[model samples]
Target: MRVTVLLAAAAVVVTAPRWLPARVVALRRKVFEKVNGDNVITFPNAAVGPDRFQEVYSHPAANGRSRGAGLSDLFWYWLSPGPEVHQEHLEAGPRYDDVARTTRALLSGPADALSAAAARCAARVLDETVTGRVTLVRLRDLMMPVWAEYFYELVFGEPCPREARDLIVGHADDVVSALKCTGLRHPARRARLTRYLARRVAAGDVRHPLPATLTPTEQVHYLQGTFYNTGVVQMSDAMAHLLLALAQHPDVAARLADDPADDRYFTRVLDETMRLYPLFGIAHRITTAEIELDERTTLPEGSVLCFSYPDYHASGHARPDVFDPERWEHTPVRESHHIPFGVAANRPCPAWRLSPLALRAATGEVLRRFTLHSTVAHTRSLPNRGACLLVRVGEPLPPRRLARIGALLRVRDRWEHVWRSVVQLVLGTVMVLHARRLRLAGRYFDPRPTAGCRVDQPPSSQENTA
Candidate 1:
């Protein structure tokens, strides 16, 4: 009986992130509707049932006292109740935090340097994918080191500190220690880079914000954000999906390969690719107060709200799922309904401009060299299932090795299933008992606008709709 109870509890805990908050969100909606009467903006299919798929909407007040989830704040692990493994796959932790900080720093610190670094990294990634027996995930894995080196080089310059080198090359075991090295080096390096940028600004060479303006700690944080949290995962996912889409549509691939200089085609391809397979596909928020949505609907304080294109895109676009770049030909690119980088209103991705250009160049390079073949049919889930959509450059892995790999993959899947079930039962009970507290904690970040981003809303006129 005790064992059965434990199992039951785990099941509830595992499922709590979805059902519990959803129940509260629903109950609060009804209560508010009764009290306020008919003004509450009714969310279509807001309640996420056991099928675990539903459409939800959030209305972020364009005024003060409301806040949106930051890039660091929004995540599946934080939003959903699942095993730690779900988040682990997304790299949603301290390591991710470090990477996010770095990426952000690179964005605002040095534009030219950042773009150059990204270009070099793209070239390297393209070279590897063209030559090696590569899959989307494997190519991305190989590109990580190249990106790290270029990033550090742009920041710290050649003959990078031994500690920094050790960290990037994976020689260092402790990520914290590696970060510490960057933490210490950043202050002095930032000062120097700042002075250089100032000179460039004086000469009218630079247009973006100076990294020197940020304190050493802030600079380091921003730099970490750039590579780990933003660029590596999102860009990689976009590239993978683009390759898959191209593989499936050889006609498009041939046309794109023919015109490397045609910027329009490149932009359309990249935009459509991002629309279809956004890596950070979901936008999440936690309500700070009772959000009044047109006087009829109000979201309760501390409520978790989420939006994904897959769920909500149909309201604005016709045949949203069909991979058609021509749809974007007539429509605006930055429509609020289309949030590839993020919801444009509250939390737009800092690397939005850079991500596309880098990806387009990479795509062009890849198409220029080899004809890609899709080994897998579809993408797995959010934060992209890189393993699911397999690709081969030339020859497949040898039969013996392929069998061993296949066996290992099956074993891993089984273990994950068992682990998820066990964890759900164990954690689900705790979650049930403290469901309210969990929802309150699920907000991810405080209720304040993220710094260093435009305050303007997307063309759809939603404030930080992500």
Candidate 2:
């Protein structure tokens, strides 16, 4: 009995660090559940079991009675179970109901309604930002539809049909239907999309080539996953945070307005903004087999592995809470752990490069169009949802400066061409390396079970369970 106790103690010591973050997260969740009512405490190492990936990422069990709800669940599954997931329990929160209700309303309108609504949303965003009369909540509303429409068009090769668009836009409901055991809404949508694609194929009008390997059904779901997981849900979140950063640092905005072509500065600002407020707070991964962390530590095959950006960004830096873009300037070596998207070498977000471009375009447009102003009270609206910004839009750029901007714009175009070439080259290199790695692993263009970790097998259980 004494020997058994000693061996258990030794084992705990050996494996503690490997599982320490997860344990800390579990403890924090328990504490949140106790202090803040409606917190959903997840099962320990939920990402480990093949049965729990949906529960970890999508939490399909969270929807209420509303149709087309819970479609835009964020990526972090560590600190908080999805806002909607708690609805499965007795003590659900208002957030779940709010997301469901809002999504349903947003998606209930006709298909063309979404495209029209997106145009209106874009118009409002441009108007508000140009006038300097916007808040984070308002920004979120304006930008959400834009991303939804973009993803919809990208996936389906045309604007979403009114009915189909409604279902797709209400991500919560779509995700629940796709992932959860609730009902057949998602499956029906997949079938409709598949049939539509088949018709297009038959007519030789297909805009994008369908992957020949996957079944038509699998192809539909694959498109849906690409649409949902890439950057659609996070675009508004990232843009809102960037705007908040700009509001606080108007000098940055001024510099951007004056030298709109200086993408290096914009890249630094973007890096810092993402460092502080990454859209997905945590990234999820799982071990496929028992792995040794060191001679002393071994993790089981089914262990859930999480990378917490908050913890990682907070540690190993000075004044991490402060908004400082200069920290990422070309001064020191970059760390591998400060990943906002997944690791650049492996499972980076498909929208990673595109998102920064969007932010840059939006920032330049707003700065060039209006004189922006905000107060501390307005900035506080960022962390808390539903609060409006206390902002004031001043006069538009005078004709004289506008002419100067036009002249500068010509120079900027030349600079941008050069910059874009460099970016493309770097991106091409990264893609080549990523492709090589995939080929080496024997899973190029095929879905792998472990997102961050590689193992001998691709964990077939998740595909079956999914």
Q: Pairs clashing in candidate 2?
A: 69-172, 69-173, 70-172, 70-173, 71-171, 71-172, 110-162, 111-161, 111-162
Rate residue 420 of model 1 by lDDT: 38
Clash counts for all predictions: 34, 9
* Residue-wise C-alpha lDDT for candidate 1, range 1-466, written one tens digit per residue: 9999999999986765445633543553343234322122222344432122221232353211112322222222122211111222122345334444544554453555555565666566556444545443433444444445544555444533434433443421112111211111122332333343334345533233334434343333333333333344445446657776776566777778788777788778777776666654344445545765446654676554544555544446678677777787788875535556654445457667666656665666566556554433334232113233233435555657655654665455444444433344434333233322332222423343334422231111011111
Candidate 2 C-alpha lDDT tens digits along 1-466 = 9999999999876655456534544553444334322222232233333233233333223222211111111111110112112222112245334423322332234444433444443454466443444332344444555565555554444665555544444553343322211222233443444455445445645345544544444434344444443334466667667765775577886777689889898888888887777665544444444555347745555444444556555555678788888877753525422556645433345455455655666566556554443332222113221122323345355656544654654344334334333343444334333323333222311355466434532213222212
Query: Model 2 segments beyond 4 Å from truth?
Result: 1-28, 31-137, 156-168, 172-206, 228-230, 330-333, 370-466
- C-alpha lDDT score of every prediction, in listed order: 0.44, 0.44
The 10-residue segment with the lowest total lDDT in model 2: 70-79
> Model 2 residue 63 lDDT?
21
Error of 2 at 181 (Å): 19
Which candidate wins on TM-score? 1
List candidate 1 stretches off by more than 4 Å.
1-105, 108-116, 125-139, 157-222, 334-336, 380-466
